[model samples]
Target: MPAKRWNELSPRTRKLVVVGATVDAVLRIAALVDLARRPAAEVRGSKRRWVLAVTLLNSVGVVPIAYFLRGRRPQPA
Candidate 1:
């Protein structure tokens, strides 16, 4: 299907889209910052691979969420 232009979207649809994009951006940034600060030994897999995946994938928050949930090793109490 053809994509609708921004002006053509209804107010509710536009609002939803904007909110979704904002949330996705926030998640991505948070994930990236955490990845950068955390040591390599604290990460589950290759840091290079995680960087690529987190930066490149447009999973609408899935990739970032995965990075937080499965990528990092738990810190000692």
Candidate 2:
């Protein structure tokens, strides 16, 4: 049989997971929107570069939060 719970997790871990998921979703959506609005020809423009950079930064930044979320949940003695 599969385990029901892998022990109780600390409050911090739960927060991290939720925040990471949320941020990642937001960044991915923004990137998609940016790509859809700007055509290939327009990508050379400064505005397009800025938009792409911001999207990339957000996506990369979310990794740390994900790690914290992945941390093992502590079990009560």
Candidate 3:
């Protein structure tokens, strides 16, 4: 879905989607980080690189949504 669609959603819905995406992004980022720690000999080939690239992209994609959702939270009185 487009980022514009996120803006159209209700704050509650946007928060849920952003939080979910953030968690997903973190998990994928962790996996990518772990892959780097492994020895090159143990790591696979193009498959590993592809996974890392995709994860990086997703991690980047989650940032704006998360930021926008954070701003949507009601301030405590």
TM-score of each: 0.95, 0.46, 0.47
How much lDDT does each candidate structure score? 0.94, 0.52, 0.54
- The digit string of per-residue lDDT tens for model 2 on 1-77 reads 65334245567777877797787777556555655665554443354554555456645555333323332233336
| Over 4 Å off, model 3 | 1-4, 40-77
* Clash-forming residue pairs, model 2: none
How would the candidate models be sorted by TM-score, starting from the highest?
Answer: 1, 3, 2
- Shift in Å, residue 75, candidate 2: 53
Poorest 10 consecutive residues by lDDT, candidate 1: 49-58
Give one digit per residue, the lDDT tens place, for model 3 in 4-45: 665688999988888987777675665556555545544344
Order of quality (lDDT): 1, 3, 2
**Candidate with the larger lDDT of 1 and 2:** 1
Deviating ranges (above 4 Å) for candidate 2: 1-7, 44-77
- lDDT pick, better of 1 and 3: 1
Q: Which candidate wins on lDDT?
A: 1
